[model samples]
Target: MRADAVSRAVLEQLRELHCLEPEQTVCCALSGGADSVCLLRCLLELRPVLGITITAVHVNHHLRGAESERDRTFCQQLCAGLGVRLAVYDVNPAARAAQEHCSEELAARECRYAAFAQVQADWIATAHTASDNLETAVHRLVRGASLHGLTAIPPKNGRFLRPLLRVTRRQVEQYLESLGQTYVTDSTNLTDAYTRNRIRHQVIPALEQLNPSVERTVSYTLRSLRREDDFLHQQAQAAYAKCHTGKNTLSGLETLHEALQFRCIAMLLEEAGISCEAPLLERLAALARQGGRWNLSGAVYAVGKSGTLTIETVQLPEPLPEAIPLQMGENRLFSGFVLHARLETVSPAENVANIHKKFANACLDYDKIKGEIFLRPRQSGDRMQLSGRGFTSALKKLIQANLPPERRRTAHVLADADGVIFAEGVGCAARVCPDGETRRLLVLEILGKC
Candidate 1:
């Protein structure tokens, strides 16, 4: 926050990167941390001279319970006090990591980048200092880096810009101190629980003894590595273009250098939404050169024949579960959620219409449903008249209109011998809706992940 004079170095870096164009807007990724606060304030102070607008964005991972809320509230108050537009994104990195089968750290980074992608601005600024750059490089080195992963953090990547790449974390603290700015500290950072925290707490300090300005030195080395990596990437792109014949087909991959071949394979897998280990990559590269079949990630397989390679994803049919009786108490359905069913003694004096509207997708008239009720995935030609909608609509049409595309495959319908009575996403059928005369109610509530 000790901006203006202190921000000259950052301004020069931005100018070199051509990031702060006149009249353009820059959205700062603020986390209510010292580094991010300094970056936001610095950008705000430099806004007038650079002829740019400054805004902020924050993503709350919600992993720290009360601390998460504290960070979010601090970001909001800080943005309001500075009169800057702020955008906030709530992300559950743990859930995303589980779904993607990746580490929570990687998931959080992906979520942050995704949030950055949503901003309607010329540039998205992140508060990554030289210290962070060193830590990232070390962490990647410890794990193993195949390509540009070892190059650590870049000053600019697409629309994302790290203005303080050259600035050290100590300098950030000094800047904020001079301006009397306060920032929140994440409690997790104080512990060495995570791999990154361990590296930051133990490994970096050891290296600092070797060179007092180790962060700066490491940063310079990483910059050079980044340029070399970028050059190789361009070569790989050109090589892929020449070898790529058509969809899922490649020819003359053996002609390219091994590095280019591996890089090309990596690019292809990424495009196909597949991730594999280095050993599998080596095997796949060999398969691409020679003619053979090799099992790849998930249901995907690499097939090479007649001096050509192709990726074939064997999509085994995901058969729906057999229709089951809608029993009382808890029922786990094919939709990966629990449906709690129970009978309640609802009086005629109760606001039946209000109850129907409130739990439209859940409740149904037990008396109206003839025979035993069964739950199954939506079938073709199934139609139902939804309560209050006043029209009979096809189940597929109703699902298309009401449910998100991802949820459509898991949508279920409750049916009896007569017809459909309720849809998972859509409301209950009008014939099964409780009226003012109804004395009992069959309440169905969806308990996700239960």
Candidate 2:
């Protein structure tokens, strides 16, 4: 294909991928390199036809001495020549690297994205080409990466868009040459010191010599892998929904294939906002296959017993506090308290059931009691009369029958002017049932710790 045709094809692909609208503002990340320069020039050329406004963002990593400054100046001049606005940010790459405890490349990337996010553009466009994706895939595969890493860089990630991923590096240079555009070349790109440069200059070419079209083949393979990866994610989600009990259990996990099992466990951990390392996952898998127990963050554990897997959170050392008084429609926050409350209306029948549960020390009807509901630490004299038993029982006896000894003192009780109406870790008073003519509803949700 001719250079112009290839350039047009790339531009069309970008236009489709970006879904450019005339009114939308696009921020193009420019480094004055051939790839970025070509990207900026192409977008400028298409602006009138696509009815979009273009803005150039140049992030000076301050790594290449005078060359970095020159690139920013060149980008500013280029944007001026094209009648587009330019935004420039100077970042201390070395300082950031030290602070973030990351390599210079990763620090620079983070700084670049942070700058992009600060810019007032609706979308940020980057000039990552197909060659970069191929390089990334090869690099990650060599490092023993997962399927997600093998997929490499996605074309669209959040507010960032890579419009040139379908294009080649040579095609970008050719397009720039056709427009008589000169771009700065970074000396670091030629050095073998960086892993990416070594792959770009040495590894890719050697592979190409064996198969001449390795880049294209790798790109196609990535596309296929991405589709398969998406399908596996859907299947994993469905499997997770079925075998997952309200409480953690590994019983059904053994039935799944090894790959799905790992995926399901990872998803579960992710949903729980728990970090899952590869070693931990392997340990969990080993425990599932054998009779052993492994402990993880937040005192959670996985144990294999009798060909079944069970994941459970360790019981808290301290007992939960009692339920506190909450105003109508108010949300309550209590430390070590399992029950939460909100006000809602209930019919008379529901009120009677609620009162019965309260008398039986089962549920708390917070609205039925008169006076202010206060939460206080358990006192020695606290007592409540059981409805069916017709006998007043000491709080200690009530707690012994229901909870462990460790929870006796830590438990709080809800009280009013009448007396200890509700035991914090237990039930409410039976005498405070709402009358039949009552119209208001109060809703209290009690959540138990896992």
Candidate 3:
């Protein structure tokens, strides 16, 4: 491909995407690779025609040791030759990956974008060509991407623009050759350790054996897919609004078709600050059809019951507050609530079953109440023989059935050394409740919103 053709393609993309404005500033991500080198040079040459200023920003992810510094030096020299301002950022990708608990590739990308964001430009330009998008599509496909992921990278995302997205990787190298420019090669790109490198080196070459122009074909296909995706997203938004109830929950979501319902469920999960993937969203939608419950991330849960789907955050009581010893007959603050425990004697005329009816206060057999009692947040394995109920059940389930989502995080319970004796919202344990022969009673009252 001719250099002029490559440059023209970039200029056309810039204009078509509305990425350039008169007297605007652009920060080009220069990695000293052929693609970035061609992009920076083309933007500089087109600066006069487009009435835009260009600056080169290079991020050195110090994973390749000395080679990383060489890339940075090459970028500095190239920018100097072109009389362009250059900003260099040295980042340790291994350290960042360890800190963020992510892969090295993800850390490098995050660090690169961080450098771009600090450039103070009207637009941040990345050197993603059509071939790069092809690699991205294949990578996401291997990772089980949905239709939206298969659409690949956008030409312009927020303040970031890809001017060379219409051009192929070969065209970029050809453009640099025509300009007699020198570009540095990263040794890691030749290895197949990374998924993208494997795709570029092995998968793409094998794909080209069948369809030589596969990159361009994928580019065309992505354009159509993106348009369809946009339409579906709009429809999903409308459906979500129609089905949405208060407090980040949705009702009657099962009335819509499965496809639209999935999208609406995804939207609701996102609004509830949950990062749900496609498979998880599908599972949640299936559960919605049958009025079931799913445990979501961050101690949140999704319940689809009685034609109403609700997302709730279960608040667990603090461990410190739960460990504190309780003193009888005095009001004490614990986990933002007031608690008062006292010893009471049963009256001769009083009926034990009638006394247990008061749900807020737990009536326990004083003889069974052994050791120092402490209050704490309900834990995962807590089970109790609930008053009136013959069998024991998980405290989490009882809370889900009774209390709202937000209240779960701070729910408190009274427990002796043996186990939980009583829980807020839930009544006293059947085994520990007062009987007809009981005389002294242990009454634990929890005040304020549970």
Top model number, TM-score: 3
TM-score of each: 0.61, 0.65, 0.70
In the range 1-450, model 1's lDDT, one tens digit per residue, is 344545987887798886566999999999999999999999988888899989899999988899999999999999999999999999889999999999988999998788778888999999999899999999888898866898988889888899998889988888898889999999889999898899989999999999998988988898889889999999999988987788876788878888888888887888788886689788887786577998776688899775567899888758877888988898877656888888877766788767767666588777878898998889888999876677888999999998899778778778999888988878788998888777777888877754
lDDT of 2 by residue, 44-86 (tens): 7777777778898999999989988888899989889888899
Alpha carbon lDDT at 38, candidate 2: 81
Structure candidate 3, residue pairs in collision = 314-409, 315-408, 315-409, 315-410, 316-409, 322-375, 322-376
Off by over 4 Å in 3: 314-450
Q: Give the alpha carbon lDDT tens digit for every residue of 349-441 in model 3.
A: 877767677533467887887687777778879988876787889988887787789777666677887888877777677777887877788
- Candidate 3 contains a number of clashing pairs equal to 7
Question: In terms of TM-score, how similar is model 3 to the real structure?
Answer: 0.70
Per-candidate clashes, comma-separated: 0, 6, 7
In model 2, which regions exceed 4 Å deviation? Answer: 15-22, 247-251, 273-283, 289-291, 297-300, 305-450
* Local accuracy by lDDT, each model: 0.85, 0.74, 0.83
